[model samples]
Target chain A: MAQIRMETNLLGANDMLAAKNRRIFKARGLLVINLMSSPGSGKTTLLEKTIEALRGRIELGVIEGDLYTDQDAMRIENKGVEVVQINTEGTCHLDAGMIEKAWSRLEHLPIQLLFIENVGNLVCPAEFDLGEDIRVVVLSTTEGHDKVLKYPLVFQQAQVVVLNKIDLLPYTDFDLNAFNRDLQLVNPQIRVFQLSGRTGEGLAQWTEWLVEEVGKRVI
Target chain B: MHEMSLIAEMMNMVRESAAHNNITRISRIKLVVGKLTMAMPHSLRFAFHTMARDGLFQGTELLIEEREVAYQCCQCGEKYLPDMPYGQLCPNCGSKASHLLSGRELFVEYYEGDSGKGEENGANTHGN
Candidate 1:
C-alpha cells in the first residue's frame, strides 16, 4: 500500500477564478459589490432605492442571480441600468464561475459600480467568493434580530450589513441592541446602515458610502 | 446542502491525484474541515457515500478532522482558541481588535491507496 500525501484546498478552483476576476475588476477600476440576503430580505428593493439615490452621480450595472426567474434583473433594468441575469437552476449559491460568465455579458457597458445580487441564501452564499470589492448582507427588520447569531458565518464574512425595512421597525419585534451586540461579536469591522427601501429613509448615508467606495477604487 | 458540491470538488481533485500516482483502488481518504467552515461532517459523509460509489472508490474509508476556531488579538498580539463561534473579542484585553487564526479551513489532507496488486488485508495498521 502506498501512502500518498496531497494537501489541496477544496475551493481551490473557485478561489483561483475569483482571483482572476479580482484582477480584471482592478484593471477596469470597477467597484463590485456582492449583495446577499435571505429570501424575503428585500435585496431587490434596496437595489432600486440605491440606484434611485445614486442615479446621476454614478454609472451602475447589476448581475442578478436567482433560481429561475429574471424578475429582479428586470427591475434593475427598468432603473435604466445595464443588467444581466444568471439562472443557477436549483443551486443555492452563485459561485465565482457564474460571476465570470455574467460579467462577460455585461463588461461592455460603461459602468463604475457593479452589483452582483446573489441568490437568497444566508448559509450557502457565504462560502462562495465572487471577487467583489465589498460584500453586503441585507437583513430586514422583519427577519428577526437572531439572524446575526443564527447565521454567523454570513454576517462574519460580510463587510457591510444593510438593515432594511426600518420603516416597519416599530411593527416588528427586532431588537436593535441585541443585533448590534451580536454583530460586534461576529465581525467587529463591519459597517452597518439602517434604511427603508419603501419610504426612502436613511438611503443617503448608504448611497454616499457607495459613491465614496467607487471613488476610492478608481485607478 | 452545499456539502454535496464540496465533496464533488474533492472527488475531482482525488481523481486527478489518483491518475497521477497510478492508484487504482483507494482504501482511505482523510479530510480536514474547520468548524467555522459550516460544512457539516455528517453531511459530507453522506455526500461521499452517495457520490463515491464507483469501483475505484469502493469501500473507501472517509476520515474527517475538525479544527476548532482560533483567533489572534491584533492589539495584544495573543493567539487563543475561542469557546464559541461568536468569540471574536480578545479574552485577555477585552478588545474587539482581533482576527481569525484558524477555523475557515476546508481541505483534502491525503489518501492511502493501492496499485491493485492484491494488497488487501496486508497489515490493518492504518485502522483508526
Candidate 2:
C-alpha cells in the first residue's frame, strides 16, 4: 500500500490569489462589490439602473461573468460605461483568477466603484472570495422566500441582500415579512433592501447605501 | 462543484512539497476548516478521494480538524461560541456588536509520515 502524508487546504490556492487581488484593490482605493444571485434575478437590470443613477457621481466599471454569451457585457457597454465580459466557459462560478484576468483589461479606466456580476448560481459563488469590499446577494420575489433558508451560506456570507423585482409583488405570493425573518435567522447583521429595477421603485435606498459604502472607501 | 477545483489545488500542493523533499510516499494529511466557510467535509472527502487516485496522495488518510466560530462582544467583552446552524444573538452580553475572532480559516497545520530516509521513523514536519 502506498502511503502519503500532507497538510494543505483545498482552498489554499484560491485564497492566495484572492489575497493578491485584495491588495491591488486596496492600493487603488476602489470599492469592489461581488454581486451574486440565481438566474433571472435582475442582477443586470439592477446594474443598469444603478449606473444610470450614479453615472456622474461615481466613476463606475463592471466585470460581467456568465457561463456563455457577452450579452450582459454588451448591455453594460451600451450604457457608456467601462465593462469586461468573462465567459466561465461552462463553469458555474467566477474565481479570483478570473477577476484578476478581467482587471488587467479594465484596470486602466478611472473607476472608483467596481461591480463584479457573478454567474447566477447561489451555491458555488458563495464559496470563492473575489476580493471585494462587499458580497451582495440578489433575491427576486418571483424566486420565492425559501431561498434564504435553503442557501444559508450565501446569506451568512453576504453583507447586504437586495430583494429585486418588488414591482411584481402584487402578482406573486411573496411574503416579505417571512423572508426577512428567515434572512435575519441566517444573518442578523445583513442589510436588506427591497426594490424593483424595472419601475425604479425602491432603487433610491439601494443607491443611497451604495453611495455611502463607496464614500467610506474613497481617499 | 467548486470542491473539485479545490481538491485539485490541494493535490498539487502535496505533490510539489513531496517532490521538493524527495519523499515518495505519504501516510496522512491534516487540514483545518472553519465553520464560517462554506466547505463541506463530506463533499471535500468524496472529491479528494476521486482526485487523489494515481497521485502522490493515493492512499493517504484525510484528516479534518474543525474550528468553531468564536465571537467577542465589542461592548461587554464577552466571548462565546454560537450555536450550530449559526446566527444567534450573543448569549452573554446580548449584543450584536460582536467581532469574529476565528472560523474563517482554511489551512493545513502539519503532516505525519515518512522522512525520506531509508529508516521508516523520522520527525514530522509542519507547514503554514
Best by DockQ: 1
Candidate 1: CAPRI quality band: acceptable
lDDT scores in order: 0.89, 0.83
- lDDT for each residue of candidate 2 in A129-176, tens digit (9 for 90 to 100): 988889999999999998887777789889999999999998898998
Q: Assess candidate 2 and give its TM-score to the true structure.
A: 0.83
Off by over 4 Å in 2: A1-9, B34-36, B53-55, B64-84, B91-105, B109-123
Worst 10 residues of 1 chain B by lDDT: B119-128
Please provide, for model 1 over B1-128, each residue's C-alpha lDDT reduced to its tens digit, 9 standing for 90 to 100. 77887999999888888778767999898999988888999999999999998977999999999988888999899888865555677888888888888888898888888878665534332321
TM-score of chain A of each: 0.97, 0.97
- How does model 1 score by TM-score? 0.93
Off by over 4 Å in 1: B118-128
What digit string (tens of lDDT, one per residue) describes model 1 on residues A73-117?
A: 999999998999999898888999999998998888888999999
Q: State the TM-score of the second chain for every model.
A: 0.88, 0.83
Cα-based lDDT at residue B21, candidate 1:
70
